[model samples]
Target: MRHTDDKELIRLLRLSDYAAFEELHHRYWLKLHKLAYRKIGDRQDTYDLVQELFIEIWEKRGTLNFGEELPGWLQKRLWFKLSGFFRKRGFNGKHQENFRQYLENQGFDKCFDPAELREVNACYEDLLAAINKTIEEMPNRMREVFILHRRQQHTVDEISDKLNLSPKTVRNQLDRAIARLRRSTEAYDATALEILFIVWLIF
Candidate 1:
């Protein structure tokens, strides 16, 4: 009767209730679409990924735990699928090259085993979510500086010119943004912390 309860839906799902699956799909599909679109930046790919995600969810429904963290689990699964896409394309050269170099510069040189890589990639997804949360919590000027530097990939001088602020002010704002993010994520485990550091290094 509790159709909106994820635990109830998951219970029905495990029992092969198509309607329950449909309800879950209806609830989450748009949010998943936006998430996939933001990550892949390709409309066709986002649609394909969303389709694949739900199909897999249905096929594997019996195995699901139906925990409170199902949404986070879904996000981690999507990141894994996104990594597979990157692997198939051999990382598209320049983007992967820059990412790898950025990590190396942050003192991460050892090759990650498949399991390690998957874990790190999942942490990357978590860090992205954390960054978004931190940005939303930041003061307006600090948020502007953070988004310009992180999302738009602007240089300090570039952001200063665009925002009509002195370069020192821009740098200080950026530093404050980083400090805020660091404080927010301080509770993460050591390995996830390293992944977050790599993300900051790259941006």
Candidate 2:
């Protein structure tokens, strides 16, 4: 029926009504997907984030809040998720530049067999991208120092000389970067091997 109301649907959804949820998805799938894809800017990332969000909504049906408009609720949740996406990577100006330069320095062009580069490029790009404009919010010297030492594999003295700063300052910046990466990647709570499912993503 064209009479569908989000409030009624949300109520039914909380009661484990598959028909209501399915209908809601059918009605809003395109709109939600498009908004998510724009923020994430990657097809798979968009799909994965949406799937996780909806799945959580399904699992927490009983506690789901929908006193206001459902579309507005979704918008708020999407923005929150986009914010989480940035925090998850510990992204900052220098950290981000370091990552870019590291990729270039490693010659991403040469890292893969030429024939396989396309596939690798697609996957890696999908991983790094998402909505987060605050990447430029880092302090200048902090960003520069973090990038030089951690990303470029520079020694503390090398970074100090390159930036005309003290070695102790470089060391402190490196420590902060290390702290950020630790916090960001810690969300997955797994090592690369585990993520690969070679040992299972969870123990």
Candidate 3:
């Protein structure tokens, strides 16, 4: 079983062979766990995600077409799971703390005056909208690299591996993406620009 290839394992899996399923899980669990932990940054959540991924694979064994690249197929599913996790935990705890600290450093008091708070909220919303538009307008590969690296917190090497590109190419894409975003935000005021920087950093 240890030496068996993925296609055979998958074929047995579709027939509900427990040993084949266990073998597949053994082969991929560590790699999947590491990737999940890197993207999620939570030990328990990473464990749960990896567990759920195996469960899903087992459940969908009959229908999933893994082709000749089982590793890639598993990784693509993990990426989708990670995306769903982030969406469900939108503006997560760390992000909220970062935002709060940014406001404090900019001299906003704990008890924000209602009107001032409203104005700040509006400005933040506008900045987000503009930044999203700019990202949307970027070239397809560049946008994917940027989102994976910055928004999804993936490292350059991770992005390179996932996208099947060289590390240098991934870095180049990120650099160009950042430069384009800066140009798009140039019309913003100093405070708005600062806010945009914070948003990029925390995300």
Candidate 4:
């Protein structure tokens, strides 16, 4: 099983082969953990995120589909996990500064001079302002629901009960609110759009 190819391991996984699953876990655990740690900057959170990724993989193994590259697929799933983690925490000034430091530590200074870094930070702030403005422009009820769910860290069920709405309605409001914010990004240029994507990931 240790020498089995990814495709073969995946095949065995779908059939509920424990050895193959263990082998796959052993193969990627360190690499995934390192990636998660770099992005999250917390040992415990990184461990939890990577563990959750593998658990999800196993739970959905029966429906799993890998294209040409299994590693890429796993990494993509991890990226989504990271995005969700940041979203649940609610991005604020501290996280923005941490991300900037992360970039600098990754040698972004070699790619972007001090002036360019300042410009990127400015664009990032501007995009955030635009998103907040869009959120504020949402319908009254929608804005309330979004604030409760996102800013106040309330779950859909909690928001529904507080607002006297169905959970489905709360979810719909959130979906529409997110869609409106996405549309607002279209007005930005490429650089701003790139910053918007990063904001989306952490927001």
Local distance difference test, per candidate?
0.66, 0.53, 0.69, 0.69
- For every model shown, the clashing-pair count is 0, 0, 0, 0
Candidates 1 and 2, the one with greater lDDT: 1
Superposed by TM-score, candidate 1 places the C-alpha of residue 18 at a distance from the truth, in angstroms, of 0.4
Residue-level lDDT of model 2, residues 42-78, one tens digit each, is 6776787777777777788898776477876775566
**Cα-based RMSD of the predictions, in order?**
8.3, 12.8, 10.3, 16.7
- Highest TM-score among the candidates is held by which one? 4
Q: What is the lDDT of residue 16 in candidate 4?
A: 91
Candidate 4 residues lying further than 4 Å off, grouped into runs, are 92-97, 102-203
User: Residue 194: error of model 1 in Å?
Assistant: 11
Q: Candidate 2 at residue 140, lDDT?
A: 75
lDDT of 4 by residue, 1-203 (tens): 87899989998999999888899899999998987775566788889989999998889889977656888777656766765676565444444565556445433534543233222333444455576568759999999997786546588899989999999999999889878877786676535334434543333
Selected candidate, larger lDDT, 2 vs 3: 3
The residue-by-residue lDDT of candidate 1 on 93-119, one tens digit each, is 333444555445434445532223322
Worst 10 residues of 4 by lDDT: 113-122
Write down the TM-score for model 3: 0.51
Q: Positional deviation of 200 in candidate 2, in angstroms?
A: 36
